[model samples]
Target: MIHPILDDNAADALVALLAVREAGGVPLVGDSRWSTQYWSAVSSHAKAECVGGDKAWASFSSGSSGAPRVILRSASSWQVSFAAVTDLLALTADDVVYVPAPLASSLTLFSVAHSRSVGASILLPSRPSSSAEHLTRATVVHTTPQSLRAIVEVIEGGAPHSMRVALVGGDHLDHALRRRCAALGIRVIGYYGAAELSFVAVDDDGLGLRPFPGVQTRIVGGELWARSAYLASGYLEDGGGPFRVDGEGWGTVGDRAENDASGRLMLRGRIDGAILTSSATVIPDEVEAALRSIDGIDDAAVFGLPNERTGALVAALVQFSPGSSRPSTARLREQAAARLPLTHIPRRWFWTEDMPRTSTGKAARSQIRLCALEKKARRLD
Candidate 1:
């Protein structure tokens, strides 16, 4: 039986405690927002509950649409993730690792664990908003594209610090952002994985991720399928049962990918709800990456909409950078043509203050697609 500790005041701490519970251990969670009551509650519970082995489970929220789903993974998976990270970062015992994301996030959890695994010191700022302070002390940092951008802002504003590496994932890493980080002497490594499947591909320590240890990837039907011991058991409540593993122990997470002739894995997008354009198929991520490279654009989301002539027309919902206005549709078209094929150029551009993101901060592709469809419908009406 699972008895999760609830701390309404601290969501990350609460989730971390629950994960500790789920992995066959007990957690003494308390309200960090309040002092005396919180510590007392935690102490009482810890004294009463049985102390178990180090192996434990933790839950994290994940989804592209609908309510977030809770994913459970073992502490061992975190160890594996950390091992890969330490290998990729070339972390040393004396290194200081910084985590800006919440501890409940798999990214942050594993990053911290990875640092600990290598005997490296961890420097977590008490506040999430203190990017500059955290960046100043750490040798390596883990961040999403958005967070990395914030770090870039700090550095550009004359923050004095140098990082050995900045690992960017949780979203597509644009070449523009990569170039900026590169100029700062911070090598940006893009990793691709989900809570359901942890650390599928990590940039191969300057060589590019050539399949990490204990993981295998294959391109089946233009979709990327993976088999790894590190894959989660399955989702809670959904009872989807265990991931389908082959006799050899390979499992898939339903991501679409392409392999270069040299066998490097390039992720396309998800298999479900992929865009089928008039001239050719459009992978939203591929197009989104292209769109993000255009000057004056901060970020973009690419998806498809119904069209009488083209089955589904490609469209982009974009947020231009500050002090920048929407580009002329013609110029936008030219920019896309420079990197993408004619079929992949978005037929229409919709400007928004910001692209909507999921609870986990991933670009909500499903929501953006729905918004595009609704606007298209309004036009028809």
Candidate 2:
């Protein structure tokens, strides 16, 4: 039987997971807020796969690029990483970890499991209103960059509390965000990983992403492939999602990466997500990072728009920092030109007061592209 989890309590969910694991059954941990129809579809898909299989757990992907799908993995996959993280973070029974994200998120589920493994206490918000209260008591926090920003805003200038460390994932943690958290006495530990390949690299001191313990990485044609015990079995779907396992036991989720001069793995986004514009390939991640580095720019989402002349033209939707006056498009263009190549520079510019993001706090590239094509977003030029 599949254990469909709707409970938000971390302790209760831990107990249920332990029980389900002991019973040798698959547990489907999902968010209760998912639409009934969507939940039914995901559960039905998982149940079909769980019948007569070695799968130990089932969860949904973040669906940042597309619809969420059922992913299956052995219990040992997470169990091994739980021990790694517990040791890496030096978690103890006395520690209180706050996980504000829903149970459906693999990041939160992994945090809860890791906390339980180390005999640490976990604080999960019963409602949106309880997040701040939980943060006040937490010795550690596990959340996305977007959620962390909201948290920083909530507790700004307040007397420091018990929270000291934040384990951030699901999006890039910008320098400004990290500095803000540091001002609040909370150290951020940003990591790069996927639900399919657990814990590929970690950045503890903001140097860069080094390989996580027990994981070996290699860049194949600019695509990163990892070999580790933490890899998931496969997806429950027929095609098995984008996860691919080689004959040599290496698995990859099609993430693009390169080794810097320091040998640290630098992510360049996904292989399939690259935009083909004017016969030149452009990685939106590279452009977006450049835009974010500009003065007064808070965030950026780069995408491709269909163009009869260029086949596809690079476009960008940006958000400026709060209290900063909006600069002219020409000024913004000059700033981008200095930082990016001609092909990487955005041809079309748009602005958004509130940027659209996935549940995991990732830039919703597909959503933004759709909005721009539909003329729903405010065209800046």
Candidate 3:
């Protein structure tokens, strides 16, 4: 019988504990103001399920990737991942780790696990905006790229914070954001993973690349496949998805990837959203990233359009930076081409005050694509 932890004290923590318990190990639940009452409920459930040799289980809220599915992770899996992160960051017991993301997030839980494994002190921000304040006394800061952007904005606005190591994840880190962090004398380490899997790759340096250890990655037919000890066994309900391994035991997340001659992995985009053009394939993420780097563009979403000749043509919908003047279409197209190949250059552009975003703060590419296509159809009509 699967006992789901309802205690709110970092629901993800409860999920992790559940996984540990299922693996026949004892797990500890920590008290947090956000989910104190919830933790008590889960603690009671754990007691009811207690058997002589049964393991303790923890539950945590996995953000937005899948439906609310609880992951059953072994205690060894947590320990191994924590140890790997500690070694990657050179974290010590004396270091002060600051976590700005919600405790329920896998990223924050990983930080907490790393701290517990090393006897380090962890400081969680009371609110998202208070992260800069917490960073003042923090040696190591773990946060999402979005939160890190906010923190850097605060710092640039005269907030006082000294950071030794900055771990950036949750979303892809753009080149523009990385350069801003570098200017602050802060070393940014980019790691890639999802709630379904632990961190599979991390880049400790500023080389714009991610590498993996204790993990095996291969690109099959342009899709990136991986096998690692950190991956969860399977989803709770569906019990099947991309996590399924082949005979070789490698699993894929359906992300298309390209590797440089130096063997560094560069994510092209999700295969689900790939646009096929007559001349080549178009990955929306690559084009969107390029447009976002252009001056005066605040955000961008690139998608495909039906074309008589090209099968599909690229289009971009963008939000301009606040108070920045918009560039001419020709100028914007030229700028995009300078950073991308001709095929990658967006053939159409639509300017908007803002683009819709998911609750997790990622651009709603599907919605934006629909809007762009509708606008084009209306014009033709």
Candidate 4:
């Protein structure tokens, strides 16, 4: 059974998932909002090449980059760690779970499965909330930092809320967002994971993230590798999208990470997102981190665009808070130079009130590049 995220209500999705599981049928979930261009890019891989057991459930994912893929996994893949995951959140039947993302997303789907295992009630995304009254009963929320930022921007009540914990992922979250969530009486738990490999690690420690109890991890040649019982079966209709399996049943999705002095995992961002400049290779996330650290900048995404002189020139799109004093492009360049390497500084800058985000609330870098090349948006310089 294939289910699109935008097709039906949360209740209907839940019922479909349960029905598939009970009937020993594979249930695949897909995002319905993909543009024609995105579909065209992956149509070559969408032929009748279905693999995996009838009992396995599949979900479409991009595996961090490039074209989308259908990932296959048996119920035990996630069920094996459900108890440990809930125990980490201290979730119980009394807790009301909330996931602001669509039901077909891996994070939201895993949250649904976990909540169902623990017998907790869930509030899926309804229309955008103008007030916090709809969230009065929510105790725990699973969302990305972008979606949470959108909620905080329009929400009205500053009164103390009932939310206790938040499972945040999908992108790199800065300390400012964490502070904002703290002010709202919610504790933020940042995690690093991929659809191919479920929950790799969580920021249970203040320094970074410690691996889960049953999870195993190692940093090999700067890429994070995992050996866990929750590993998904290989991608369908494709050789192996950005992942490799070893003889020991360990898997790696090629994400760059490192261990801090305290043995906690610290992500360095995607290995494929590095831009080859004329002078040096620059990782966009590194430049983006520096940009967001400056005051008045709420979000940032750095990319490389074609240049006549250099093979590629660094460009950036930044988001600023409404009514906040926008800094000049020269001022931003100076501040960025102090932190980032000279070659990493953005050569062209564009400003937008809102950053481009995908259905999963992740920064849409491909779209940002298109917008930058078009030169249609407001340029800070």
User: Per-residue lDDT for 1-381 in model 4, tens only?
Assistant: 332223246666667776867776666654546665654444334334455463366676643345557777778999998988888789999999888876667787788788989999988754323247546778888888887776555443454357788888888766777877777767888887788888888885445788876889998899889999888887766464776889998888878888888888888777877888897988888888888888888889888899877889999999987689888988999999988888999998999888877656677787788777887767885
lDDT (Cα, tens digit) per residue for candidate 3, span 14-119: 4665475556665543335335675566556554553333222233423222323334455455666666778777899989988876554556666776787798
lDDT of 3: 0.67
True lDDT of residue 296, candidate 3: 85
lDDT of each candidate versus the true structure: 0.67, 0.82, 0.67, 0.75
The whole-model C-alpha lDDT of candidate 4 against the native structure comes to 0.75
Q: Best to worst by TM-score, what's the order?
A: 2, 4, 1, 3
lDDT string, candidate 1, 1-381, tens digits: 224444443445645664655566634333233357644654554345443354355444445544344455556766665666677788899788776665546666566557766889876554454466677788888778887887888888889775879877787766667888888889888888777787788773444456766778887788676877687655444444323556776676667788777777877777664788666877788888888888888888877778888899888888789888666778888888999988888888777776676533577777777877776411210
Candidate 3 residue runs with Cα over 4 Å from true position? 1-72, 208-210, 277-280, 304-317, 327-334, 337-361, 364-381
Per-residue error for 278 in candidate 4, Å, reads 1.1
The lDDT, on a scale of 0 to 1, for candidate 2 is 0.82
Estimate the TM-score of every prediction: 0.78, 0.91, 0.73, 0.89
Lowest-sum lDDT 10-residue window in model 3: 54-63
Q: What is the model-wide C-alpha lDDT for candidate 1?
A: 0.67
Positional deviation of residue 130's Cα in model 2 after best superposition, in angstroms: 8.3
Which ten residues in a row are the worst by lDDT in model 2?
126-135
Give one digit per residue, the lDDT tens place, for model 2 in 1-381: 677765556557667876886898877876766688977777676665544466677777777677777677877898988767876667889999887877777777777677877889887776433355676798988888878887888788464467888889987788888999898888888889888998999989888899988899999999999999999988777774778999998999888999999999899998777889887999988999999999998889988899988889999999988889888889998999999999898989999888887556788888888889899999885
- In each prediction, how many residue pairs overlap at the backbone (N, C-alpha, C within less than 3 A)? 7, 0, 21, 0
